[model samples]
Target: MFFADGLNCSNFDRAVFQELVDGGLGCVTVCLGFWEDAVASMDALGRFRDLVRANKDLVAIARTGAEIEAIAGSGRCALVIGYQNTAVLNGNIRFPELFADMGLRVLQLTYNNQNEFGGSCYEPQDSGISRFGREMIPELNRCGILIDLSHVGERTSLDVVELSEHPVAITHANPATLVPHLRNKSDTLIRALAARRGVIGLATYANICGEYGASPSKWADMVAWTVDLAGIGHVAIGTDHGRNVGMPDLTWMRQGNWSRIINYGAGNAARPGKVAEPGWIDTMKSFGAIATALAARGFSQDETALLMGGNWLRLYTEVFGETDAQKQLAA
Candidate 1:
């Protein structure tokens, strides 16, 4: 089965990643940086590119679904470079094109706080997609970059669904109905996203998953519930796996220097807490357990395949269409 993680923040461990691919991972979207300015974003992109190049034998930068399929066929993993915020664009409309040229594909409009584009879920008030955000949508569409609303405010997420010409994704989130967390999504928003043929990725973060450390059964139940709500085709896997490296840990994701106080994402507002990786599917190698879990829940092989990766492949193929720059870069 081809597995695509919605978010992968794991510390670079080539041997471990290779082992995971050998076990059963196809593609993973790794964030370059969020809350970064243009220059820093480019720098991060360069480093990521270098990492891919260094491990070219085991992985390749996947800019298209065909490439992903081909790479998986070769028993290697495909890396899709994604960004968690548009701060890299720096309000410059031209940056999306530049990022696309640099092999950046998925881009979340905002993180957990307000930016030039819109409000974040953490904000007391959601301003929704701003004028500049409205302008960026078309350009992002044209550049063949997939729009993600994983960390956006509720209103902003809805606004994106209404405004985007192409289907947008909440690439890594759980249903709030089950967990009742801010990071999780409501049924209305999930349905709205599905109506436009957009996909919703089931998040693996414990807080969003409604437990400090969830079991495979719990995750499977959530996936089944999501499929029931959004249709089988609209559900996919986006494990928000964080890099376990203490040297460069998740401090950037939570704090980002956006706030003097630690902004514990998915954790409660009172204090920060670490998201202990679930025992069953902690690493990418264990991703196949999800398929087994689905099977146990009476999901057919086709349905299991869809949840594993086919749905994501369909969404990416459609959203990240063949633009001139993409074609040229491929050549």
Candidate 2:
């Protein structure tokens, strides 16, 4: 099976690329722009393009399933550039098309805070997707960008699924039924996503996993539980793994520039630092353990393959349209 990570938070560096290759990862979606404005976000995308160009032998940018398969076939990791927040749009409706042209494939509507698009799970009130957000959905679909609802509020996420012409994704979250974390989705939301043929990438972020963080076996149990809720076709892996990340990065990710005071994020005052990673799945190299655990939990090879990456590939094809490779096959 082709191994693809729905969300990996590691910075784009040669070492990180090498680790991805070494870990047998065929494709990975890496967040490039989060809270940056237009200019900064453009710079981030430019730098990402330059990095991929410089490491052509190691990785390639993939916007479609065919590209991902081709790049992986050539022994290079396919990198899918994603944004954790739509701040790069800066209220301009045309920015989705512009960013799509520039190779931004996956975009989350909101981060941990409320934005013009919609409310976030962390927000006290989820006012749902705004009119601007309503306008942006069709634009995103027209541009072939996947709408990700990993950090979006329940109402906003449901609103997106209902509004979008193409199926969306919860790129990195788990089942609220299993963990009850704010970042995890409720069974209703999961069922709603699956009803629209959207996929939910189960996350292994320790805080969100709660007691399941103890081991890979426990994590697989949570995966099984989610599969029962959303079905195997709508489940995948999105380890929110960040290599070499420290407190400063965590603080920035959680607080961004929205708050003057530090937000501990998923962690609280008692444990006010980087959330501890599960020892068994701590690094990029350790990702394959998920497959092993799934197999042990009675998931068949085909089901495990879907959970590993196949499900995400199907969603990518459905939302991003056909590439030259797919067109040829169709011919």
Candidate 3:
């Protein structure tokens, strides 16, 4: 789904998403923060709360599978709140339940750089989760919110997988196909996550592939590698699609930050092995591109479904604890 951000230029309005749903999307894991303070996030949350209330038919905050199904039954899509960073919490743990009530079901502890929670993948020191980070996990579990370790440090993520009572998700990431880079998880970490019943959202980002972003087919190759290592149930789709039409000057800011800068200014803007000819697109289109490539490589329908969205849906359902009523209805 189109994850519209602050730079959305247009209203961070419901209309943008209405357009995408009209265009055809199953569910959207919408963002509430990229880089903002507590008050700013609270403001955004209020706006979103109002938006959901105003357009109940068009948007409903679905924290679990049943809600998604209910929304889907009416021919609309589900909106799940996701925080790219823990900045809103801003070291205060009280916000979890507040945000959860505000429809925030997913949150990543850190963004590109380190915060109070722990070191970022981009940081020189790869220390794991801090005291506050460890302190937050049980609270997150208590509130029934899912943890997303996508951009967190290697140590921090492993620490979370071990500590979180609920299944954690690397909301948007890729398995090593094994070159070690900051963006992708190592095979060992993926196994640890899967063993703990956590979900891995295999990203189609160019950086995740390696120094060179691999081809679209290479993304499928990573999924295949991950499924082989952790099994299909642990794999899922998180397109990390940036509705670039709206949002910040990420390209410029990211250039100087966590990412190791490359020839971003020139035509070679892709992560590395990716299709440099054309750069970043939505994860679904990226998957569609992967499908054709995988077909040539003979990937079957079962595998394709797991890699696309099935595994992600299954994980979300299982981790969030669906009710018996939710089950009887979906059944």
The TM-score values for the models, in the order shown, are 0.94, 0.96, 0.78
| Model 3 residue 190 distance off true place after TM-score fit, in angstroms | 0.7
Supply candidate 3's per-residue lDDT for 263.
Answer: 25
Per-residue lDDT of 140 in model 1: 94
Candidate 2 structure quality by residue, lDDT tens digits, 107-156: 99999999999999999999999999989999999888999999999999
Q: What are the Cα lDDT values of the candidates?
A: 0.84, 0.89, 0.66
Candidate 3: tens digits of C-alpha lDDT, residues 222-315: 6667788998778766655544332134443244343565523211444322222225334222334545554555667776655555666666
Query: How badly does each model clash, as a count of residue pairs?
Result: 3, 0, 11
Clashes of 2: 0
Ranking by lDDT: 2, 1, 3
Error of 3 at 277 (Å): 10
**Model 2: lDDT of residue 50:** 91
Span of ten consecutive residues with least summed lDDT in model 2: 318-327
How well does candidate 3 score on lDDT at residue 178? Answer: 62
In candidate 1, what are the lDDT values of residues 262-330, reduced to their tens digit?
A: 656777655355666788876777888888988998899989999998889899989888757567999
Greater-TM-score candidate between 1 and 3: 1
TM-score of 2: 0.96
- The TM-score, computed over Cα atoms with residue i paired to residue i, of candidate 1 is 0.94
